[model samples]
Target: MELRVENLTVARGGVPVLEGLEFTLSPGQVLILRGPNGSGKTTLLRTLAGLQPPLTGSVSADPEQITYGAHADGLKATLSVEENLRFWASVHGLADIAPAVDGFNLRGLLERPSANLSAGQKRRLGLARLLVTGRPIWLLDEPTVSLDVASVTLFADAVRAHVAGGGSALIATHIDLGLKADTLDVGPYKADAHRPRTDGMRDAYADFDEAFS
Candidate 1:
């Protein structure tokens, strides 16, 4: 699988955060995002994940084939670890979650509810959801938050295996997972707010809801 982003622009709070962005992520590869806080990393990821629309430009390849992970963990606190995996598995039409569970060393924590697990355990469980998703493209934002060094290593290994199996990832993170990958700094891509859009491409100011995500 290959993800090609071309001339993409995304916004937050009705203002462009990133503009004129272009990149390619090929199969068995990882692309690391580097930038200071509020540099639009999360906004870019959210837009790619279809949680929001771009203010301008297009996201090439396909957005539906993507899976997103973030710091929230996306877990149901009342649900047991195994139950949570099963829920996600059903959503993606996958029956086997063994690979995901083992990949993150969650065997011992499977029966425990997410509310009872430690922060690191929850993070591991969250990343494991990606494996069961069976999607080729992954959009991760600060995925290492709350994870200890060992857990981060485990997450890195999981990502490596995912890519090795013909998948690709675009990660918005600062941690060096020790993977062979390219890095892109989004700071320079910040949108020029003063520039006028004479091409009729709707600016984020066009709609209050659509551009605010």
Candidate 2:
């Protein structure tokens, strides 16, 4: 499977953040997106995942084959670790949860409620959800946040295994994930100047009053 983006333009709140972005992701490959804060990395990932509409250009990929993991770990606080994985597996029509469980080393915390688990533990469970989806493409945004060194290694290993299995991943992160992948720096594509800059509350209020009045 391959994911392609051509002359893509992404915007946030009607303000363009990135433009003329182009890339293609092939099976057994990982594309790491690198950018500074507010450089539109997350917006690009969201666009690719089909969570938001692009202002222009196109993303060529089947939405059904894409599984997105946002910065927030989307686990039910009341559900146990195993229960959380089970629910997602069922939703994706998958029967086996063992691989996901083992992939993130969540076996020990299977019976613990997500609310009781630490940040890293919750992140692991959240990442495990991707495995159950059986999707060919993964879109991850800041996936390594709150993880320890060992946990980062585990996460990297999971990604390696996934790509080895002919799956593709597009990850946006600032920290190093220890994966051998092509890096795309979004600095050049930043559209910050395309939108007017506000320096302080006075400028913000002026614009607000201008629009409302």
Candidate 3:
């Protein structure tokens, strides 16, 4: 699978967040998106995921090209972990979600409501949904937010395995995830101003919050 963005410009509420950004990604490649808070990293990921409309330019994608995991856990609070996975699997046209769930070490949480899982467990469950979806390109926004050291390593291992299996990824993170990838800084892409954020989505895995907590 391949993903290409050409001269892409994205805006929110009439203000530009990313301008003239361009890149192409192929299977087995990983692109690391680096930037500070409010610098359009999240915007870029959202645009790539087709959740947000771009102001200009185009995005070309291959067949079954993208699977996106955002800062939001994307889980139903009322649903059990297995139910959530099953729901996503059905949506993505997968036959079964068990194998992926096992791969992500989520078997133990299968019976628990997503709302009852720890923060890191919730993130793993979200990622498992992507694995079952089986899209070749991954757009991950702050994937390591609430992870402990072991969980982080587990995530890194999964990422490497995915790339080796001919998948590509674009990750937005402030902390090092210990994955091998070419880094791109989106910090300079945003126009400088203290504008109030109009987008409702919050970073699910912000490191600062973990530190403060």
Error of 2 at 190 (Å): 1.6
User: What value of lDDT does candidate 1 attain over all alpha carbons?
Assistant: 0.87
TM-score per candidate, chains pooled: 0.91, 0.90, 0.84
| Residues 1-213 of candidate 2: C-alpha lDDT, one tens digit per residue | 799999998876566789899899999999999988888999899889877667679999999999999988999999999999999999999999999999889989999999999988889899999889999899999998888998889899999999999999999888878789999999888775556533442354455457767
lDDT of 1 at 6: 88
> For candidate 2, what's the RMSD?
5.8
For candidate 2, the 10 contiguous residues with the lowest summed lDDT are: 196-205
Q: What is the lDDT of every predicted structure here?
A: 0.87, 0.88, 0.80
Q: Rank the candidates by TM-score, best first.
A: 1, 2, 3
Alpha-carbon runs more than 4 Å astray in model 2: 195-213
Top candidate, metric TM-score = 1
Candidate 1's residue-wise lDDT over 1-213, tens digit each? 677788998877666778999988888889999999988999998888887778777777676689999769999999999999999999999999999999899999999999999988998999999999999999999999988998899889988988888999999888789999999999889887776554334543455455554
- Which residue pairs does candidate 2 place in steric collision? none
Q: How many pairs of residues collide in each model? A: 0, 0, 1
Candidate 3, 1-213: lDDT as tens digits: 789999987765446777888889888998999887877888788778876667678999854578888887899999999999888888888888877787779877888999999988988888777777878899999988888888777778888989999998898877777778899887656653554444322231233235546
Candidate 2 vs candidate 3: the TM-score winner is: 2
